[model samples]
Structure formats: C-alpha cells, structure tokens
Target: MSASLYLVAMIVIPAIGAAAVAALPRERGLLAKQVTLGVSLVVLLLAVLATAAFDVDGDRFQLTTSVSWIPDFGAEFALGVDGIALVMLLLIGVLVPLVVTASWHEADAGPRPTRVFFAWLLLLEAMMVGVFVATDVLLFYVFFEAMLVPMYFLIGSFGGPRRQYAAVKFFLYSLVGGLIMLAAVIGLYVVSTSQLGEGTFAFDALRQLDIDPEVQKLLFLGFFVAFAIKAPLVPFHTWLPDSGAEAPIGGAVLLVGVLDKVGTFGFLRYCLPLFPDASRFFAPFVLVLAVVGILYAALLAMGQTDMKRLVSYTSISHFGFIALGIFAFTTEAGTGAVLYMVNHGLATGLLFIVVGMLIGRGGSRQIGDYGGVAAKAPLLAGAFLVAGLASLALPGTNSFVSEFLVLIGSFPERPVFTIVATVGIILAALYILLMYQRTMHGPPRGVLLQQDPAEPLSGTGTGTGTGTGTGGATAASATATATRPAAPGTLRVLDLSRRELAVVAPLIALIIGLGVYPQPLLDLIEPAVSATISDLGGTDR
Candidate 1:
C-alpha cells in the first residue's frame, strides 16, 4: 500500500474492527477483547511503519492526500501529518494497545456488555487518529466533534456511579468549546474568501490569508476559548476531575493521555500559524494562564483523596508547561512542549493503570483505605512508586527531560513566568512522595488489617485477662504464641500478575529509555518546531 493509504487504513481498520467486534456473539467477551487487541496491534504497527517512512528533513506535511468534498465551499477530505502530528499519531498508536491490555478486567465491573466497551474503545481510537491526520480545517472540526460520542458512552455507560453526571459535564464542556470553534471555523473561511476571492477550509490555504488585526483578535478569541476549555486550563478545567474519576480506567487513560493533547496541539497547529500577529499580541495573557495553571493545579492535586482525581489534576499542571512552551516562541520550548505531550501520556497513563490495579485489589479509590500495601504486594507497590516518581519528573525518568526543556526554553522569553512555574516542581515532589508514602508505607491498616470482630487480636491471650503486673512473663508468652491465619477481607493483597506486568513493562522501558536519550524524538520534533518559530518571527536561542 502507498504511504498515504497507510494513514487512511490506520483509521478505517479500527473503525471496521469496532463493527466486527460488535457483531460477535454477546457471550464471547474474551473473543471481543482479543479481537480488539489484535486490531490495536495492527494499527500500532502501521503507525510505526509510518514513523519510519517519515523523512525528518522533508516537506512540512508528508504522506498527504486530498480529495475534494464540498467544492462550492472549497472543503476537501484532506489528510496529512507534519512532525508534530506524526508524534501525536505515534502516541495514539502506542497507547491504544496498552489501554486495551490494561483494561482486560476493567469492563467486568460495569453493567454494559463487554463487547460494547471494546467496540467503543476501537471507535474512539479511530476518531483520535482522524483528528491528528486531518489537513482540512473542516475535516478536523468534524473529527473533533465526533470524538465526543464514544467517550460519552464510555463514561456514561461504563463509568462509576456518577457516570451519567460526569459524562454530561465532559460532553457539555467540549460541546460548548466546539461550538465556539465552529464560529471561528466559519469566520476563518469567510476571511479566506475575502482574501483569496474564494472560500476554503484547507489549513494550508487559510494560513496564508492576511486577515485584519482586529478581526484576527476576535477570531483568535473564539478559537482560543475553545482550545482553552479543551486543553482545560484553570477556570475551564472543572469537568476533568469528575470525568477522570468516574470514567473507566481505559477511558480515563485515553481521556487524559491522547484526548487532552488535542487542545495544545490545536494551539500549535492552528492559532500560531494562522494568526501570527494575534498570537504575539496575546502571548503575555496566555503566559499568565500557563503559570497559574502550573501552580494552581499542583496545589489541587496535593489535596485530592481520590487516586484517579489526583492524577488527573497532575495532567492539568503538566499541560501548563506545554502551553508555556508553545507561546514562548522558541524552538527549544515548542519542541519540548510537543515531546512533553508524548511523555506525559506515557507516564500519567502508567500511573492511572497502576492506580486501577491498586483499587481492584483493595476495592476502594480512597487513599485512606490503603496502607502498607508494599508488605503484601511488593511488586505492585514498586510499580506505583515508579509511576509516582516519574509523575514528579524525577531525574532518569521521561518527564524530567521534557520538563527541563520546557522550563529552560521558556525562561529567556518569560523569566518571571518561568520562575513561578518552576515552583510547581517542588510541589510536585511533595504530593507524589506523600501519596506514595500514604498508600504504600505505614503500618498495615484499613483493608490491609480488617479483621472479623469475633476474632481475637494477634497478641491477645485465649480468654485470659491479667490485671497483675507480670508484664515481662506476659510479653514472653505473647511472643511465643503462634500467629493466626488471615480471615477474609484481611491482608489479601497480591502482587502483579503476568498480564499486569506485561502491560506496564513497555511503559517502564520507555520511561527510562527516553530519559537517558531523547535525541531521536528531538530530531523529529526540532525541525518542525524551528519552522514554526521561523514563521512566528522568533529566534530559537
């Protein structure tokens, strides 16, 4: 198949797979899961091949193909990828399979049919792929709006007790943003018509239009609000905690991992290139939001009792760094922002997966309910610790390099904002370590030590009470007594199974591998970032 066809197939195959999985016998949940996994693996392979075929020093957009769709309006069913889009595509590719694997037993808790769950997941993947590859602004908007359907179902049908509420909130927030963007999309086409003597929604064509300064600001606000809500900066970020906490682990992973990146990606792909004057005009205001998000979200994360909610808040703070990098108008920061998108997905996705496993074992999302988990499940605790440390951007982990790049790159351009944002790292360390200590250390308590009320304590004597001061003899007798076997609901934690290990192994490898050397990813990202900076009339240094 030709290279452009590969992009089309990456989308079509999973969509077809979703239909096929949905058609299978309702009783064959295991088969549906297997088929979904197989489909995701195939897509991953295609993504890898596409990455390999991508020439780093090539056209701004590669593997491109366009077919006219709405001739009167100058819209087309166009598709392609630049370095930024390609890396995002690779992220979608890597994550979907891991989510499928990690969610093996996640569907069992929900009332929905397992086939439907996997099917929705497959469909969501296809939509995510479409969003990144779409070259036509109209095509991109359709995919952007279309993504809400599967995710809505994923949360509303298969999420926690408040699934419906959370799903509605998520949908409404995104829907409102998308509608505002719709106005901007229409406005953009109008400007194109006036400038070029014809209407068009092709991104390449629209970027060349010399829009009026005032008009650009108005149009920029419409697009910026939509992306801010989607990127979920402060004030617009309330929906994420509810949605993230209520959605199934698999849905939550994709929600925070690949889905959130769309907003920041939009800013890079659309806002800067299309309205250079407007982007520079609004840089200071955006930088304020970015710095505020880093500090504010980090504080919120430290106070969360729900494990999933805590992780989701961390993503908000991480996104601030991405926004800062983008507006800094420097190659180092913009490239770091792109790389941060990929690394955050890996690190935070792994964190959610492990937290899900912990909740599965202990039967609670409350951090107060778990203590000394390490004693019973050392491997699981170790995985959670690694994920937590990576979340905090510890040295030798993937996030550290990206965070480093973002801070250093943004500093020269926006020193005060960069300095304020750096404080988030200290807060990050405190929250991650405190969370790990509370959940993994301390004396075994709560679920770890719940005992039958009828059963005697481990150090107690059999129906004997001594009021006398023979403490030495009593202590010796208690030490010599045999320990009782554990009863149900007590000390039942088990270590990670083979399948669970298989799920996390690749993420762990990537975390360390990319941390040690990020040059390969940098090579693919830097050229594109430089091109973008050049367009913005900024110097990399």
Candidate 2:
C-alpha cells in the first residue's frame, strides 16, 4: 500500500472497530470483546505490512502524505513515520491485541462492561497511533490531549476503589501540561506567521522560522513541561503510580508502555529539532532531574507495598535513563534511548501482566501477602522472574542490551552522570529481586489454596476468596488420587492459564530475541540518533 493509504489504515481501522463495538447491543458482551480483539489483530497485521514495505535507507519521513486538516489555521492532516515513529507504531500494534486478550474478562466484567470498555481500549489505540504519525504539531497536540478521555474512564470506572482519585489526578496533571504546551504551540505558529506572512502548524513550515533565542527558550519550556509530566520524571511522576496501580491491566499496560513514551518522544521529535539553543540551555537541568529520578524512584520502588505501584516507580527510574541517553547526545546513547523505549514497554508490560496474574490468583498486591508460589505456580513465578530480571536489564534479556549501550555511550560524554545512573542499575537489581523473593518464594499462603474458588480473577474485577496469600501446598501431589480427606479446604490453584500464556508467550520471545540479537533494531535506530545529535553538534566526547 502507498504511504498515505498505510498511515490512514493504521489510524482508521481501530476507530471503525471501536464505533462498531460501541453500536452493538449492550448485552452482546462476548461479541463486543471479539470484535475489538479482531480489530487489534488486523492492526497488528497492518503494522507488519508497514514494516515489510519500509525503506531502510530513505527520507527521514517516509510514507508521508499531507492534506490541510485546518486551512484557516494552517494545520494539515499530514501523517508520516520516521524510523523512531515506525518502531513506536509497531509497539502500539503489538501491545493493543495482547491488552484486549489479557483483559478479556475485565471487558466482560460488570453490567454493560464489554461494550464501553472494549470501545475505549480500541479508541485509545487509535489515538496513540495518531500521535506517533502526525507531522503537524497542532495535529499531534490534538491527539495528545484526546488520549486522556478513554484512559480517564478506564481508571475511574474500572480501576480499584480509589479509581476516581487516580483518574482525576492523572487527568489534571496531563491537562495542565497540555495547556502549557498549547501556549508553546501558539508561539510557534506566531513565529511561523511573522516570518512567512501566514501562520502554519505544519512541522516543516515552523522549523523554517527563526524565532528569537529567548522566545525559543520560552516555547521550548512550554513543550518540555508537558513532555516531562508525561515522562513523569520525579516530582512530576507521583501521578503515575496511582494511575498504574488503579487502572485495569490493559490500561496500565498502555499507560506506561505507549502514552508515557510521548514525553521522551517529544524530546526527540520536537524539542531537540525545533529549538536547538533552548535544548542546550536546558540540558543540564534536565540531566540533573534525570539522575535524581533514577535514584529517587528506585528507592521508592524498593519501598512500595502495592505491586503495580512498584512497577510504576521503576518506570520512572527507567525514564530517567531514557532522558539521560537523549541528553548525553552520543549516537550510541541516543539509539539506546529509543531502543530502551521499545524494550521497556515489552519488559515492563510483561511485569504488569505477571503481577496481574499474581493479583488474580493471590488476591492482594502486598509483598508479604504470599509465599511459596514458586512451588505451586512455577510458570507464573518464572514469568514474573523473567520480567523482573528484564526490568533490572539482566543479560540475555532485551532491556540489557539497550541499557548497556546507554551507559557505555553516556560514559564518554557524561562520565559523572553515567556513574550515578549506573547505581540505579544496582538498585534495580535489589528492588526486583526482593519483590520476586517476597511474592514468589517461601510457603504458599492460605488464600492461594481455595476449596473451590469459583473462577480465575480477570483484570481488576471483584472476586472473593477468604484469607490472604495463596502459598500453601495442597499436601497431596497431582499424580496420586486423594488418599484421605483432602485438607479441610484447599484446592490447587492452576498455573498460567492459556489466556495468560497467550499474553506473555509472545512478549517472552521478543524479550529474548531482541536481547540476543539487537542489531536489526539498532540499525533502524542509529540513523535517527545520528541525525538528531548532528543537529545538536554533538559527538562522542
């Protein structure tokens, strides 16, 4: 397909699916779920096709097609993907289907659940793809803000008891950031108009304007604040843990895996290129915050009792590394940073899935709530461990390669910052291993052993089981028949179900595949990194 056709399909297909799902009768739960899942699969296939057709050595913006989206305002419905956007779109395509699958039961939960929930999920996917592909800054911002709606409802309506609180916090923080960015967007337009005798929100047109350095810094901050909040770099990061902890598994997956990347992505796509002088002026401040985030968030991850919150904190720490890689301004570090975005989504999304499984089976997010799960649910424990190791960037996992490249690359340009960020790695190992041991090791909890637990918990849907932690063994092995009265009230909890397996299996493969042989991904990333750093006049120190 042509680039315009390809880009249009990527955005429109899911939107059509969402509307279709929404129009279905409220009682058609299973059908609604199926339709949404099918749409996501189709999107995934489209992504594969796009990848196959991509020109490895081509213009920065390939498959680009533009038409005026807003002629009066000079904005266009222009869409394209460079190497950076291409990978992000692929990541979005991969995650949405798994998200629909993983949260199938969540979609089925409550009265009238599937129709609205699935629709929102698909809509979220549509907006996410739009953000990555839009070449018009105004168009990018519009999609950027629209992304919050579905997420807000997902968290508020479907999340934990405190879902409303989490949803509101997330919305308000993002709204404030968006408003700040709106000012910057206007400033850029004003600059474009003054120079060219007409206003335009087209990215290319705006880039040609020569705004005063002071004005550039002001506009840059407007955009940077928005991206940083989305990145959740430290003080700005508090909203993330609450949102991640409260949202349904699918929502949490997208929240961290895709939406948040917009922050760092903004840095790469907009900030660096649009305002070079401003970027240089702010580099040290951003660098300091990135380092602070690494240590501060890791320490908090060490202390979190809620499993999802811990994962969120760890992401904050990881974002720190991503920010460091961008600012370090070496080709290797920048490439590693972009690669880290993809790897973090896979590894951390895996962590969330495994943790969701544990919460489904064990009934609580607390670390001390369970033990001896390794013996009962080896597959579950193993999956959790692999994800944890990946979070810590263990060798032989996808994240390790990216993290190594970032650190090694940064050392030449920023030795001290690199040294401090390295400490985050050690801290990462501590938090992840400790979380694993506490949740997966020791004896199975009483809660884990149910007499006849009705059905497996799906997503955050309410389910009942008395007592806490499901660590205790059933005493009898599966091979032998029940010789005696099977202990008072204990039935074996199953290991990774087919649905859960379906979610993690693909991710597990990618985690290992990319970690072992990352050259293919790096090839796509290096050229873009070089171009960005070249703009900054930066090279290996």
Candidate 3:
C-alpha cells in the first residue's frame, strides 16, 4: 500500500476489527477481547510508522490522502495530519490498547454482550482517529459527530447504573454543539462560494478566504461554543461529571483523554487560523472563561465523593490551561497547549485506570470508603500516588513540563489571567494531595473492611455497599473496623495484579520520561504551532 494510505489503514483496521469482534460467537468473549486488543496494537504500530515517516521540516500536513465524495458540496474524503493532529493520533494509539488492557473484564460485569462492548470500543477508536486526521472540514465534522454513537452505546449499554442518564446528557450536549457547528460549516461554505465562485469545504482552501471581520465574529462564536461545550469549560461542563462517573472505566478514559481534546483541537485548528481577527478580538473573553474554568473546576474537584467525578473535574480544569495557551498567541504557549493535550491524556488516562483498579479492589467509588489503601495494597497505592502527583503537575511528571510552558508563555501576554490561573496549581495540589491522603494514607475504612471484596467486584459499576449506615450496630462495626487492626482474614485489599501492572507501566514510563525530556515532543510540535501563530501575524498585545 502507498504511504499515503497509512492514515486510511489506521482508521480501517479498527473499523474492520470492530465488525469482526462483533461477529464473534456469543460465548467467544475472550477471543473477542484478544482480537480487539491485537487490532489496537496493530493500529499503534501504524501510528509509530506514520510518526517516523513524518519529517519535522516537511509539508504542514503529512500522510495525506484525498478522494472526491460530495461533488455538489465540494466535499472530499480528505485526511492528513499536522504536528498537532499527529501527536493526538499517537495519544489515541497509546491509550486505546491500555484501556483494553485495563478494562479486560469490564464487559463480563453485565449481561450485555461482551463482543458488543469491545466492538464499540474499536469503533470509537476509529472515529477518534478520523477526527484528528481529516483535512476537510466536512469530513472532520462527520467524524466529530459520528463519535457520539459508539460512545453512546459504550456508556449506555455497558456502563454503570446511571449509564442511560449519562449517555443521554453526553449525546445531547455534543449533538447541540455539532448542530451549531453545522450551521457555521454551511455558512463558511457559503462564504467560500461567494468569494471563489464555487463552494469548497477543504480546510486549507477555507482558511484563506478573506471573510469580513463582523462575519468572522459570528462564525467564530458558532465554532467556539461548540468547542467549549465539547471541552466542557465551566457551565458547559455539567454533563461531564455525570458521564465520567457513570461510564465504564475504559469509556471514561477515552471520554476525558481523547474525546475532550477535540474541543481544544478545534480552537487551535479552526478558530485561530480561520478567524484571526475575531480570535484577537475575543482572546480576552476566552481567557476569562479559561481562568474561571480552572479555579471553578478545581474547587469542585476537591468536593467530589466519587473518584471518577473528581478526575473529570480535573480534566475540565486542565482544559482551561490548554485554552489559555492557545489564546495566548505565542508559539511557545500554542506548543505547550498541544503538548498538554498529549500529556494530559497520559496523566489523566493513567489516573483513571489506576483509580479504576482501586475501585475494583474496594468495591466502591466513594473516597471516604477507602482509607490506608496503601497499607493493604502497597503497589496500588504507589501507582495512585504517582498518578495523583502527575495530575497535580509535580516537578518530575509529564504534566509539569506542559503546565510550566503554558503558564510562562501566557504570562507575558496576559499576566492578570496568567496569575489567576496560577492559583489553580495551588488548588490542584490541595485537591490531589487531599484525595490521596483521604483515600490511601489513613487506616482501612468502608469496603476495605469487607472480607474478599475483590473476588466478585467489578469496578466498572456502582459499588456494592454504603459504609454510612444509620443503624447503631452498623456504625459500631464501622467504627471498630476503622479503629481496630485488620485481621488476616478480614478486609483484604488486593495489590496490583501482573496484568494491571503491565497495563499502567507504559504510561508511568511516559509520565516520568517526558517529564525529564520533553524536547523531542516539543521539536515535533513547534513547527506547526509556529505556522499557526504566523497565520495570526504573531502575538496580539
């Protein structure tokens, strides 16, 4: 196959894999899982090859493949990747397999067909890859909206007790955003038709149109609102906590890690280059939202009882940082924003997976239910600590490098906003550290006091028991469990199984490795970011 087909293969392999997995015998769930994982690894290898073939100094978009589709609309099945898209592809490649590994037995938790769950995962992977790779606005929009379907099923069919509610909210929010974007997409095409005597949805062609400043603002708002809802900044973020808390762990990882990035990616890819004047005009307002989201979400995270909900809030806060970097109008901040996209995926994905493991052992998602988890499960505790530290952007974690770059780069252009945003780092420390202390550092409490809790526990759903009972005997038993020592046969929390260790090992390596040396990723990201800044005629004061 031609090298240009690499992106095509990346998308096709997973799609075909999904179909195959879905075709497996009902009893062949194990085979279905193995097949899905194998397919994902193959996609990862292709992503690596695509990355290796990408010349840093080459054309702005690489591995491009185009074919005409809707002639009347001037749309084509065009796909390509810039440094930003390539890195996202790499992130998608890395996370999907780990999710598969982490959620190895997630399907068996319900009477839902195991093959169907894995199939949705593979299908979702394909759509996510398409969203990043598409060079045509129409094609990108299709992938963008199409993504909701598989994820809807993944969450609604295979997720926790509140899955249906979460799924509907996620679908509705995304659908509304997509519909608004559709109007903007149509308007953009109309603008192109008037200027060029024909319509085109090609991203490169559209970006060059000399749209009126007033018109740009209108178009900008449509796109910005869509992305904001997707990124889920502040008020638009209400749906995420529910979705994250209710979805399966694998679904939660992708929901926050990759799906949410599309919103920020849209800001960088569409809002900036295509609407430069409007971008500058609206920068201050966008920054206001960004900083507000950071502080607000951080405050909310500190108050969460469900571990998944807390992690989701942290992502909304991190996205605020990404938005700040993008609107800062510096190559450094843009690069940092793009890098943060990848690093956030690594750190947050690992955090979700590890938290899922904790829920698995304890049979509960409530933070108060877990105490001194470190004592009972040292390896699990160690992993959670590492993930928490990374989420807080600790000095030697991957998040630190990206977060540092975003702050310093944005400071000069928007010092007030930058300073306000900086306070979020302190808030992040409070939330992350407090979460760690409450869950892992105290004496065993809640479900950790149950005998053989891990045996039938599936961390993907609602926990088995509520430790908070009004009964005197129950309260006394709980008090006794917390005060007294754990007996050899009582309240046993399992350490990280070898399979779980294998799952998180790569993410831990990347978190530490990239923390130490982010230059390689920066090198790959800088050129495209620079080109984007150049399109806007450099930083706006």
RMSD of each: 9.0, 5.0, 4.4
TM-score of 2: 0.93
* TM-score between candidate 3 and the true structure: 0.94
- Per-residue CA lDDT of model 1 for 1-541, tens digit only, reads 8988888998999999999999999889899999999999999999988999899999989999888889989999899988998988888889999899887766744566779999999999999999999999999999999999999999998776678999999999999999999999999998998889999999888877888989989889888988898887887899999988878888999999999999999998889988888999999999999889999999999998888788989999999999999999989999999999999999999999898777655445677766888988898898898889889999999999999999899999889999999999999998888889998988765543322222211111111211101112233333232122234435656677777788888989888899999888898888888888887788676
Per residue, candidate 2 scores C-alpha lDDT tens digits across 319-413 of 99999999988889999999999999999999998887777665556776567778877898889988999999999999999999899889987
Among these predicted structures, which one has the highest TM-score?
3
Q: Write the number of the candidate with greater lDDT, choosing between 1 and 3.
A: 3
Global Cα lDDT for candidate 1: 0.84
**Candidate 3 residues 373-440, lDDT tens each?**
78888888888988999999999999999999999899888899999999999999999999899988
Clashing pairs in 1: none
Instruction: Please give the clash total of every predicted structure, in order.
Output: 0, 10, 1
Ranked candidates, highest lDDT first: 3, 1, 2
Candidate 1 lowest-lDDT run of ten = 460-469
Residue runs of model 2 more than 4 Å from their true location after superposition: 449-456, 461-492
TM-score list, all predictions: 0.92, 0.93, 0.94
In Å, residue 304's CA in model 2 sits off its true spot by: 1.0
At residue 504, candidate 3 shows an lDDT of 85
